[model samples]
Target: MTVASLEYNGKPVVAEELTPEAFKKFGYVISPKDQAPKIPEGTYGMAYRLSDASIPVNNYGNSEFKTEAPCAFNLQRFKPPKALDRENKVYNLPNVERHPYTTQTFFPMGVDAEKAAYLVVVCENDENKLPDLSTLRVFVARGNQSVTYGAAVWHGGTCSLIDQLDMTMFMYDNGVKADEVHLVETSGLRIEYHL
Candidate 1:
């Protein structure tokens, strides 16, 4: 589809409330509901566990998924953009990135307990292995929520709604080019959101 023919003045996409059902296509939503104590006693902590059996993980062969030597553990701090006035408006999106061989998880931290939210954008790959702009989706995430993106899922950078945010990022890398891939929109496309 031509970029001009798309909605949102050719660049705007209305972000929706993040939900487990709506985000299943991209990856798993690690929310309180999903992590409810599975045991009858409900005494053990952290009822959910992540493994290759349940989701895609890159360093299965390694005894421990270590990031200090090869992979990277990043503590990213996202600051709210100055242009953001309304919660429903997503002003601009320059590019998107994805980890093809690894699953990435974003764990929120150091956010205000009362009011903390962020934006998540994802897109599927087309036949050409490029981001299918038509499949793009936007989600608003709260502070208590963490998202684990499946391998090869196109996603944008962290965007905070409050003044500041801290998110712990986990990913695997072997000093190779295949670790991450970034894609830019050539048609000057920008997505805006409407209420």
Candidate 2:
């Protein structure tokens, strides 16, 4: 079997289309069919539960789980990389991060219907508890769907393929420091995605 490398100078890994089965290791894919709302005859609506208490309390301890505060919800806007303006080729991947104690979700919104696709990069941890660079995978997500990252899974920041993109993010925290660990130094790797 051939191994994969993350670094890119010009030629980069082409991103694959996002799918539920392909993204299982990273987290849950929130689709209309899987997230249909339970309602009465006269009601019209849909719901998608992002995360739950099913996440294990590992390093944060039991006290961290006892907080009565609700999860934080915020809108995040992403801008396309400058490189795209010059050569419509690839987006550089400088860093990746993970939330050790809680699941994180993002719902895309306010996207131009004609160009609403975005990119997501992820990798699984190796035996040494560091990101397995060879396992890095890229995905293109549509605006109609939401994604929930599993606790402690490595993932890059949100990116857009078009000029501007907005997304609603949900996660447990004080909404201050963004409880996450950057894996760039530990993994010592970088990557790029083909446009």
Q: List residue ranges in candidate 2 displaced over 4 A.
A: 1-11, 33-70, 82-86, 112-116, 174-179, 185-195
* Native-to-model Cα distance after best TM-score fit, residue 187 in candidate 1, in Å: 5.5
The backbone clash count of each candidate, in order, is 6, 0
Candidate 1 C-alpha error for residue 155, in Å: 0.9
- CA error at residue 172 for candidate 1, angstroms: 0.5
RMSD of each: 6.1, 6.6
- Cα lDDT tens digits, model 1, 17-113, are 6766789999977765444444566557766654532254675244243343255679898787654554655546656677666788888896543
For model 1, name the residue pairs that clash.
Answer: 11-190, 11-191, 11-192, 12-191, 12-192, 13-192
Best by lDDT: 1
Off by over 4 Å in 1: 1-11, 33-56, 59-72, 81-88, 112-116, 186-195
